[model samples]
Target chain A: LQGTVTRKWDINKLLYANNIEPEDVIDRVYNRGGDESEEEDIEEEDFFKKKIYKEPSNEFDSYKPHFSDIEMLKNKWIFDNNNSNIDKEDSAGNSPFALISRRFILSKKMIGEDDS
Target chain B: MAKPSNIVFQTHRNFRIRLILSTLSGKPIKIEKIRSNDVNPGLRDYEVSFLRLLESITNGSIIEISYTGTTVNYKPGLIIGGQITHNCPITKPIGYFLEPILYLAPFSKKKFSIVFTGVTSNKQDITIDGIKWGLIPVLEKFGVRECELHTIKRGSPPNGGGEVHLKVNTLLSSPLTLHVTELPKISAVRGIAYCTKVSPSMVNRQIDSARSVLNKIGCEVNITSDAWRGKNSGNSPGFGLTLVAESKKGWRIFVEDIGGPGETPEDVGTRVAYQLFEELSISGAVCRSQLPLAVVFMVLGKEDIGRLIINNNQIDSHLVHLLRDIKKVFGTEVFFLPDDNVIDQNNENNSILTVKGSGFTNASKKIA
Candidate 1:
């Protein structure tokens, strides 16, 4: 009976009264719930894509630096196996001269380099 | 020899690849269910146009289409390549027709000296720049001589009007064997930016933007611009960039991009340059889209084994299907082995593909 007062329980107020930081509760309640990997991929992928995902408000602000091809290779067939849109954005045509040229040099012993 | 039965195919997918393989292997093909379920069904105008073009340069070739155009029966004939003119449809670019013909021309009775008129560049198809810089070099590996691609007029889509002359001499008795398992560093980079029916300034603008990114490769870059005016220019205004990077071994990789409505010249140039940069960073021996050509050539080479080391990233569904189709038509098996000898661990994800050539020669060519 002593603890029978049905008071409205506001976690924020309780945390405030106790000087407790409701960090975890705040994240769960207000965060958009995207997983960590998804967030990380979005951040890394936007700069590599040629097509502008969104309109630029200002010219200078939308400038994306050119990424090294090695860096671009990081987004290889791993993503393609899932049949993702990223592959579609860059894939060559199924028929004809797709011209998707990235052919690297193929040397064995570094010796037979005579094809010129 | 008995006339081989037709290879039955379903759907309109990969119509061009199948057509070429059938022609080269002398296998008749029956294609059915071409968009049979679609409300507006039947073979598209481009396919019909392409068939007509094939028939013109070939002897005794018979292509019969059903009344509804849903079914097609193709019996390929000897390629008597000499001089021909084809007015291609706007549904596909001029490169669409050229890609297949280039493969057939090497084994023709004479040599290929053809003119193609149609949409020169578009988003959905390969462009002329790609044919010259990308495809042609691969053909050169087969010892196809006196090869040249001259753009007489620049055209865009919709109201398309463009003319191009493609001359390929030296009908090979047999395609040369290819054994490029490794590549040297890129020695130089070159490109051409073209603008038609638009301000000539667009060409320079596009070239500058492309060079801005390509210059970082620390290699020599020579990018030129071509601006067409008046009658030579296509009906629609458009601009595009095509780049070719030559390896020390003389093998080349290509990059290209076209400016569409709402896209700025800078966008096309930068995108193409970045595409090339990205391509160079990958460890493949050929560009992604051109893998089929390289593989097909190897398959059609002399009976000796031809070897190629390809970056694993270049293998996609398209390459997978192309390999299957080649195996089906040519009866040649291609072998892929793990490439564990790469010096750098970062570039170790590759395979060595070896195809035993069928020793296919120009059967129709008369011997001296």
Candidate 2:
């Protein structure tokens, strides 16, 4: 549960579910992996960077992806699945937003049971 | 037969039309209406146009015609057509609220209907009776024939702010020239009373004396130029009560009082007002009719930012509470208009309060 397999599984699914244009997300991830393995002192400019977005003016404009620097969403599925084992009530009482999410999850579980 | 030429013109109601036709052979041609067996739209249009032309020709001329179209009356053309134009229009008249009672007067010129609030400058609290005596007689002098007093709800309980709507039958030289200015000079009296400070007690006493004096006399008297405000800080501080009384000697005496020191005009005003209220009540009882009346107390003083003390209270945070209190004391129909801004701005120790009573039915409805 605490190994490289966890990291590999999370990044792969995040890369697919977000439809991150495989070429862009993977290329950046691979480039970052390469920089980590190498001992070379890479300049900030040399590091792989996510794309920035500009405001869309009108309809028919292509859907643009947000290349967020803080990639919490990159490991969202793995983090959530693993944390499922933790007591939800403890986390829910910590914050109001979490309480809302906890209620949503509970309602969804109830609906899933009804469907089954 | 050759077709007649078609013409068209637009005109307003009460327009006249005329026509003249001459043959080239030096003989006059007779004009006659053509009968159309079928419904011809074009023919109808042509007939209308011909009538317009006829109207254009006959304007202003007093000419006799054998027959004319329903749309046009025959007149002389010489008086009708010109290359010039002019414009004139009439507007509706505005209304005013005269105090301490509200009297209806025709506007000098009709512009638009208007409703305005009037506040008495009297600093003391005046009563309904005092106001009736102080104000009614003056209105009678201005030629007000009769007055109908009103309360909040018609025939409802008495509220100090009862309203008085004076039926003004002052005839003007001509209806065209609406004459509203002839009503007893209420503005003049109100102007003096509102700005001046006089005790309510003295005002009532003066009104009583004036009533008796006029009762003793048989002729009408016009009294003016008495300082109704508190003491010149000199001579017996005058009474603020103004009244017209029938004297035992067959004369009407118009009496007014200015004020003096050590007397509260507010108390006197309230007392005199009570006298009028009683009289009104008696009149209603005798007639077996319901009377509607209201009293509005507008107290403007210098406090924190010139608070407008409406009915002796501030516009505190809880407005519903304030309204409930007012309703309990002055009947459900009373209203208070405050001027807190003026009070807050002025650092003066003295403040001005106006207590006005009028018929309730006539009072303007307040929009929350």
Per-residue lDDT, model 1, residue A114, is 52
Predicted candidate 1 versus true structure: per-residue lDDT over B231-264, tens digit per residue? 9897888888888888876677776777877989
lDDT (tens digit, per residue) of candidate 2 on B40-107: 21123323433433333223333222333323323323212212111101010001112311222211
DockQ of all candidate complexes: 0.03, 0.01
Candidate 1 predicts chain B with a TM-score of 0.96
Interface root-mean-square deviation, each candidate: 19.1, 39.6
CAPRI class assigned to model 1: incorrect
Question: What are the runs in model 1 whose C-alpha is more than 4 Å off?
Answer: A1-116, B1-3, B341-346
Tell me the deviation in Å of residue A72 in model 2. Answer: 97
Docking class of 2: incorrect
Off by over 4 Å in 2: A1-116, B1-118, B121-240, B247-252, B257-261, B264-368
lDDT of 2 by residue, A29-61 (tens): 333324443423333443344545322121111
RMSD value for candidate 2: 35.7
Q: After superposition, how far is residue B251 of candidate 2 from its true place, in Å?
A: 7.2
Index of the highest-lDDT prediction: 1
